[model samples]
Target chain A: MNRIACIISYDGTNFSGYQVQPNKRTVQLEIEQALKRVHKGQEVSVTASGRTDAGVHAKGQVIHFDSPFRIPAAQWPKALNACLPDDIRVLSARYAEKDFHARYHTTGKEYRYRVLNAEDPDVFRRHHSAHVSYALDIDKMRQAAAYLIGTHDFSAFCAANTSVIDKVRTLYAVDINVHEDELHFILRGNGFLYNMVRIIVGTLLEVGYGKRTAQSVDTALRTCKRDDAGKTAPPQGLYLWSVQYND
Target chain B: MNRIACIISYDGTNFSGYQVQPNKRTVQLEIEQALKRVHKGQEVSVTASGRTDAGVHAKGQVIHFDSPFRIPAAQWPKALNACLPDDIRVLSARYAEKDFHARYHTTGKEYRYRVLNAEDPDVFRRHHSAHVSYALDIDKMRQAAAYLIGTHDFSAFCAANTSVIDKVRTLYAVDINVHEDELHFILRGNGFLYNMVRIIVGTLLEVGYGKRTAQSVDTALRTCKRDDAGKTAPPQGLYLWSVQYND
Candidate 1:
């Protein structure tokens, strides 16, 4: 028996989410259906690195599944793609070592948020990004982001629904890039709490729009209060860019 | 009454086509419905720069309509966008000079065709582009394109369904750009025949696959026969990029 890991990408436009739901269309259910076909009528289950919210895209999501039959790892992508929907694609597949886990063995993760900061609507980017009509001060947002980097108790950036208690998380980097009329936020962290990235983005946007300051972000982190941060940004603009695992 | 010109963009995935059809959702019908609402439930019609096939997108499609009531040019877009669907957006609106026409006065047009030449599927671009599994020779396609440029009687490129008699059209440029795993073809001409751009693209794709040569395209033009060219490409890959007008 072997654990096989594969990298997959999805558009997320029409999906309920990455999780399996009874009656809803989801990325997991679609892939699982394809896996069932590949296993010749035997039901198969797949575990992903994490669950992306509804309408959140993924560029390189990692998943692992136990195979009922022997198959080459390199051919997994092609075989799975044949059975999968066009919106979901397997990019690469590889054999994992014994005791390998897709979620528990992860070392870090990276997420990106795209914002279209323009007056006129861009037809091409309607689904891929969140539109902000008001101009943003990207440099100011960068200044506020500096205080969020490194280890800290990020209770202010987390949503209220999760049952997890441990609030300490190490953020490696928080970078913002401005292109034409778009602002992209690339975040790297050891682990994120529920709604952490979106809340952080919403807070940073306050700084961009002159509603908050870098010092305010530092205070928000020190206070460990959720209300200290800005509103949670929409999930549509967020993407699970890539995942990191131990070598 | 004043002539109003507006630039609109659309996804075109759910639209039947640019023109009106019975019992079908179309770009024109949507806009006309929106226009009717803005005019207090009075029916209104709009003339477009040209008609695009079903499933074909647009970046800068122009439309002109005569106003029944006086409204500021800058206000038209905001008014219409409120009633338009999410797939369609009014980019800009302005008052047109006396007798300014969207279709008849157009000087030239530009069309773009996108092709994803890769084994791996690009989930994000699945709707906006055509996917080809085989590798393409861009240089060979470019060579074939060179023969198609300039003024020529393009009877071989027109669709068999069109009733237009004159086949002479000026091709200003034909550019093929390769980016990573995608190939983009941009074509500019004084005017286009029904399905002319798709036919040209199909012929160029044959050249890229080594099935046809540059000389074959030259002979097809000289022969002035529809059967001399290749098959018409699919509409999903094509976009009405822009329409040139005399300022």
Candidate 2:
């Protein structure tokens, strides 16, 4: 059997999420089903780098699977793409070491959140961006994002139901870019907790709206309470931009 | 009654076409339905600059309607948008002269066709562009496009079943621009026949693939025979970019 690593992109609009759930349409189920068809009824399990929530898009998601077929690495994308749906595409595939894991071997990740800061929402971007009619002060948002960079225990920004004990993670960068009527928030980090990036964006947006102060983000980090931060942003605007690995 | 002209945008993925048909969802039907709701059961008729086929998007389509409401011109978009669906949006609205007509007062129009010239289709652009896997010679396409410019009888580049007697039209510009892996065909013309732009694109694509020489476009224009040109491209890649009007 050969181990294959694949980079995939998916439009998460119709998916329940990236994980397999009973009877729910999901990205994992589609990928595994396509693999099964390619393997001629032999069940094949696939593992992704991580799970993304429903309605969250992906540009460079990584996955690994073991297959008994002898297809070349470069032709795997073409083969699998023929069986996959239009919304999920296998961008590239390559042979990987037997010991390589898509999930545990991941070193860092990059995420992006898009906001349409316009009076009226764009019809074409309805599924790709979140609309914010209220004016946002970009300078204040930048100041609040500055407080989010570097190492911090992001328990205040994490989801309440997550059982992960260690909330400390090193944030490499937080960039807020303006593209005409859209605001793109790019975050890079060694790791992120459940809804951490969304919460951070939500808090920073509140600062832009004058509902919170830049110093309040520092206070939230120190307090480490879920209520200290802002509400979690919606899932549609978030994208798992890329995954990093130390090969 | 006051005449109001509005600039609108639509995704066009879910509509049958721009014109209303019995029991079919259309852009015109949606806009008229929204107007009816705004008028509280009073019927309102809308006239657009032109009709676009199913799956053909619009960025700045012009429409005119008569309404009895005395709402401010600037607030018309917001008021009408509240009643319209998410796939359609009113970009702007303004009062127009009583003699002005959306269909008859148009001076020119701009249309764009997007082709994804890549090995693999992008998931995000599935609904926005047409995927062409084969490598294209852009220079050949540009040369063919140049032959299509200026005033000519475009019967060879129009749909075979079109009943329009006069196929003569003046094409101001036919530009083929390369942006990364996508090729954009922008056409500005005084008018177009049925499937004119799409047929032109299909003919140019044939030239790009070396199936036909650039000189064939000139021959096709001279002969004015439908079979002399290539097939008609699909509608998804076509966008009614904007409509021109001389005030």
Candidate 3:
């Protein structure tokens, strides 16, 4: 059996996120169903790098599945895209080694959180971005993000429900960029706990808004208590940009 | 009394055009309802630039409503946008002259039709564009479009149900530009009869595919018969771009 890797993009608006939930629609379940239709009526199971919450979109989410059928690698992308729903698309497909796992083999990951920084609410992008009406000092946000990089206990930036015993995680990079109407938080990390990225973004946003200082990030990182961190931004603004692998 | 004008943009995927209909939801009716709520229990009526068929979208569609209660012109754009549904947005608003009419005072109009010219469909833009997998010659289409410009009898390109007696119309410009996977057909005209723009685009697309020659456009214009033109393209790809007035 050959391991097939697929790069996917999804709107995630109508989905219950990337995981398969019983009796609920999800991006992973839809992909599996489409694979079944394309693979001669055989039910297929797929494993992804990570599961995103509902309403969280993706650009380069990776997944892998083992199949008995032999099909051209070039045809797999089109065939899967045709069978998949309009909100989800298989961008690329390739054959990989048997030991290649989408989740376990990941070396790092990148995520972006978009906040629509505007006075008036954006009606069209309401579902795709979080609207922040208050003015923010992006320079301060950038300064605060500098403190977030490197290995530290991220329990303060994680959700209360996270079951991980080790709160230490290595953040490779964090950058904040501001456009006319958007503020983007791009983060690269070895691994992220539940809502860690969003919480970090929220804390940085508070610093940008003058509610907290640039040292607030260091304070949150040092203290492994969840209550010391800022709130989690909405899931709609969060996107799993890409998963890294050691080639 | 105030004559309020509003510029609106809509994603027509879920709308039944911009006009009111019995038992049908329309952009006009939705805005009117929102106005009624703002008018302190007074029912209101709205007039738009023209009627767009169901599923057609607009970016610069204009409308006017007569109101006894005055709303600040600067604030009206936000007021209506806030109360209106997510699919429709009021881009701008101004108080118009008492005799100003959105349809009658229009000096010229612009329309654009988008065709996705790629083998693989774009899932995110599926609702806003028409998918055409076949190869198209942009030069051929542009050459064919030249013949359709200027004043001529456009009955061949008009829909069968069009009630206009004079089918003669002047097309100021017909541009066919292709960028990567998208083809934009931007047409500027004094006015368009029902399905005129779509039929012209369809005929030009046929010319691009070598199914018809560039000379066929002139022949169709001279013939003044509906059979001489190609089929009407889908409404989803059509956008009422802007309406111009001489003031």
Candidate 4:
């Protein structure tokens, strides 16, 4: 038995997301179906590093599947891509040890959220970005992002429906980069709860728009309440950038 | 009545191009309907620089319309954008002289054809560009493009079914620029016949791939026969970039 690992990229525009859902098209299901076709008639289950929500895109998602058939690792990527849909692509594939796990072996993860900061609507970016018409002070948003780094209780940033009780997570860094008509929020952490990155982005936007102060992020972390944070950002602007694993 | 000139941009993925077809949706017909809605039940006819083929995109298409209503010229661009579909956008609008015409007053026309030169299939660019798996020599393509410049009878470049009798046309320039994995063919001419740019691009590609020689272009032009040229490139990769007028 071989633990086969693969890197995947998907558009996520017409998909329900990275997880399997009943009767709905999903990135996992599509890739699995493609794998099944290559395996002749055997069924395969894949485990991903994380499950991104619907409308959330991915560039370097990592997944692992166990297969009984001994197939050449180098040829698996091309075979998968040949059978998969155009919206999903298998970037790379390799054979791993039986103990290798895609989610459990990950050391860190990176996510990015994009916001279109402009008055006039961007027709080309309507589906891929969140539009913010109001003027935002990027300096203030950058200042607030510094407070969220390091180990802290992120209960305030998590969604209200999150099942996890332990809210402590170590955030390695939070960087806010601003372009001409777009703002990118890059977050690196050991692990993230449900809707945590989107909530943090929303809170930072409040500080940028002058509705909240730079210290508000620290206050929200201390409160340990979900209501203290801003609304969750839309799913379209969120992307699972990459997952890091220590071999 | 002042001639209202407007610059339009469209994705061209859904519509049947700029011209109105019987019982089919078109960019022109949709904009006209939107203009009628804004004019409070008045009909207006629009004339464009050239009729783009189906599935061909445009960024700087010029069109002119005459109306009896006195709408502010500065507001026309925004007003038209608000009513047009998401795939179409009015970039700019202004009032021109009564004698200004989109097709007649045009002095030069620019068109660009993009080909994705790669073996790996790009799912996202499938609809926007042509995927060519053949290896091409950039320098050879550029050398062949130089022979196509200046004035010549372009009968061989036109489609075989075209009905135009006058085949003489002046080509101001023909440039072949290659990027990382993209080959862009930019052509500037006084005017182009049906599928002329696509045919030229196809023939140049044959030259670049060593399937044909550069001398074939001149020979085909002298032959004055459509069969002498290569096959017409796909319409998906072609874009009507801009139309210059001597205003």
Candidate 5:
């Protein structure tokens, strides 16, 4: 069997989440179903880089699965896209080394959060962006984001219910970019815990709104307390921008 | 009585059209209903610059309504948005001259057609852009668009069943811009006939695909026959960008 890796993109608006649930729509379930069709009804389990919450979009999520078919790697996207739904697209496919694992081999990940800062919500972008009508101080948000860069214990940024014992991770960069009325938070890291990106964005937004101070980010990291951070931002504004793997 | 002019925007994926029809959901009906509620159940008539077809979006549609209440014009958007659905928004509102007519006093209109020219469809933009998987020659399309930039009888580029007798209109400009995998057709004209923009876009796309030559546009213009032009493009790709009035 050939181990094939693929880069995929999905619109997560209608999905329950990236993982499969009983009788619930999910990005993984749809992708596996499409693969099953290609395999002539044989079940094909696919492994993704990570799970994204419901309503969280992805532009470059990676996945891998073993297949018996010997089709050309370049033609895999066309063959799989014929079976997949419109919301999920296989961007590229290639044969991977037998030991390559989509999840375990990942070196880094990038996430983006979009905030629409305007008095009036945009009708076209309502589903894609989180609307925040109040004024935001970009300088404050930038200041808060700066405190998040580098290796640290991100327990405060992760979901409280996560069972992971090790919450330490290395953050490569944290950037806040403003375009017109939209603020985009771009986070790149060696790895991320559950709900980490959303929580960081929420905390920085609070700093921008003057509800929290820039130094609070440092406190949250040092204390490793989830309660010290701000509320988790909504899923609609979050996008799995890309996943990185050591090639 | 006060004459209120509002700049509105809508995602037309769900509506039948912009015009009010019995038992059919429309942009006009929603606006009128919102106004009635704001006016304490008193019916208010509204006039728009023009009607957009089903599945056609708008970013800057202009509408005028006469209201008996003397609320400040600046507060109109906030008040109406409270009652309007999420798919439509009142971007701005202001007092208009007593004699200003939304439909009659309009001097020109701008419409945009978005074409996603890529192998895979973009799920996030599925409702907003038209996808064409085939390769298109941009230079050919630009050459054809040049022939369409002038005053002419556009009968060939209009819907066959349009009741309007006069098909002559002055086209101020027809620009084709390419951005990544998308092509934007921006058309500005003194006025347009039924399905005129879509038909023109269809014709231009055919030229881009090498199905029709650049000179065919001139022939279609001279013949003024509906059969001489290409088919009408889908409505989802069209947007009423703005309306210009001689203020």
Candidate 6:
């Protein structure tokens, strides 16, 4: 038996989320169903690096599964894609080193938030970006994001009602890039908490719109309180860009 | 009463085509319906720069109409978007000069064909691009396109059963731009025959794959027969990019 690791991409417009739940369409459930078909109705459990919220897309979401029968590493993508829905696709698949875990072996993660900063709506990109009509001050957003780099207690960025108590995380970098009327926020870090990336984007947007100050963000980090941060941004605009693993 | 010109954009996945038919959903029909709603059931007419085929998209489609009641140019987009479906959007609106017809007064037009030349399909971009698995040589495509950039009797590139027999048209420019695994063909011309762009793409793709040579394209053009050219490409990969008019 071999453990197979796969890089997956999907359009999240129709999925409830990445995690499996009862009575709702989800990425994990669909993938597991496809796996069962390939395994001749045998049950196989799959694990992802992290769970993405509803309407959140992914480019390189990594997963690992143990199969009773061996399929060629190069053919895994085509095999799985044949049984999967049109919105989900397997980008690549290969055999993993022994004792490697998708969640635990990760060294860093990256997330991106896309915003359509335009006076008129783009019909084709509506599902992929958050629409903001007013002009944004990208410089102010960059200033706010600069304070987020380095290790800190990110309690202000995490969502409430999470059972996990530890909020300390190390952020390697945060970047804001503007392309024409599209604004992209890319953040790379050691790890992220529940709703942490969304909260950070929402906070940065507030600064960009002149409603919040960069100094306020620095204070929020020091306090380690959830109430000091901005509201969580919508899930449609966010994407799990990629996950990094140790060499 | 005022004649208004509008720039429109739409996702054509659901529409049959741009023009009206006996009993099918179309972009023109939807726009006319929205116009009727704003005019209190009064009849209104809409004319486009050209009719797009089924499953074809448009980025800068131009249209004009005579309104019974005056609606300010700035408010036209908001007024129409309120009644129109989500897939179609009015990007901009302005007053049109006297005797300015969408189809008649145009000086030039631009069309784009997008192809995802990759090993795997991009799920999010499936509707907007044609996926090709085989390797394509960009240099070959450029060589083939060079022969199509001048005035010629383009009957070989036109679709069969077109009533307009005058097949001569001037192609100003043809550009091939490669972005990683995505290839774009942007062509500008004084005018185009029915399905002319799609046929050109189909023939050029053969050259790209080494199935045909650039010399064959020149021979096909000189023959001025439909059998000389390759089959027409699918409509989903095509887009009416823009229309140019006198300032």
Q: Which candidate gets the maximum DockQ versus the true structure?
A: 2
Q: What Cα-based lDDT does every candidate model obtain?
A: 0.91, 0.93, 0.88, 0.87, 0.93, 0.91
Q: Which 10 consecutive positions of candidate 3 chain A have the poorest summed lDDT?
A: A119-128
Task: Report i-RMS for every model.
Answer: 0.9, 0.7, 2.5, 2.4, 1.1, 0.9
lDDT (Cα, 0-100) at A105 in candidate 5: 99
Clashing pairs counted in every model: 0, 0, 0, 0, 0, 0
- Candidate 2 lDDT over residue span B32-100, tens digit each: 999999999999999999999999999999999999887889889988899999999999999999988
**How big is the RMSD of model 4?**
3.0
A63-92 per-residue lDDT for model 1 (tens digits)? 999985668778899899999999999999
The local lDDT score (0 to 100) that residue B174 gets in candidate 5 is: 95
Give the clashing pairs for model 3: none
Q: Model 4: per-residue lDDT, tens digit, A1-247?
A: 7889998888777899889999999999998898799889789899999898888888789999988767777788888988988888887888888998999999999998889998765554655678888999988898999999999999999988877889999999899888779999999999999999999999999998998999888899999888888888888788888999887
Q: DockQ scores for all the models shown?
A: 0.80, 0.82, 0.43, 0.40, 0.70, 0.70
Error of 6 at A184 (Å): 2.2
Worst 10 residues of 1 chain B by lDDT: B66-75
* Top-scoring candidate (TM-score): 1
Lowest lDDT 10-mer window, candidate 2 chain B? B67-76
lDDT of 5 by residue, B33-127 (tens): 99999989999988999999899999999999998777877789999999999999999899999989999999999999999999878888988
By DockQ, the candidates rank as: 2, 1, 6, 5, 3, 4
Give fnat, all candidates. 0.75, 0.93, 0.39, 0.29, 0.75, 0.86
Task: Please tell me the TM-score of chain A for candidate 2.
Answer: 0.99
Q: Comparing to the true complex, what docking class would candidate 1 get?
A: high
Q: Give the runs in model 1 whose Cα sits over 4 Å from its true position.
A: none
Q: Which tens-of-lDDT digit does each residue in B1-247 have in candidate 3? A: 8898888888787888878889999988899999988887799989888989888988899999898867678889877776888888888899899999998999999999999988867655677888888899889888899998899989999999877999989999999887778999999999999999889988988898889999988898888989998988888889999999997
Ranking by TM-score: 1, 2, 5, 6, 3, 4
Measured by TM-score, how close is model 5 to the native structure?
0.94
- How high a TM-score does candidate 6 get? 0.92
Per-residue lDDT tens digits for candidate 1, residues B1-247, read: 7889999999888899999999999999999999999999888889999998788999999999988667777789899999999899998888898699999999999999999998766989888998888767888888899998899999999998889999999999999998778889999999999999999999999888888887899999999988889989888899999999999
In model 6, pairs of residues that clash are none
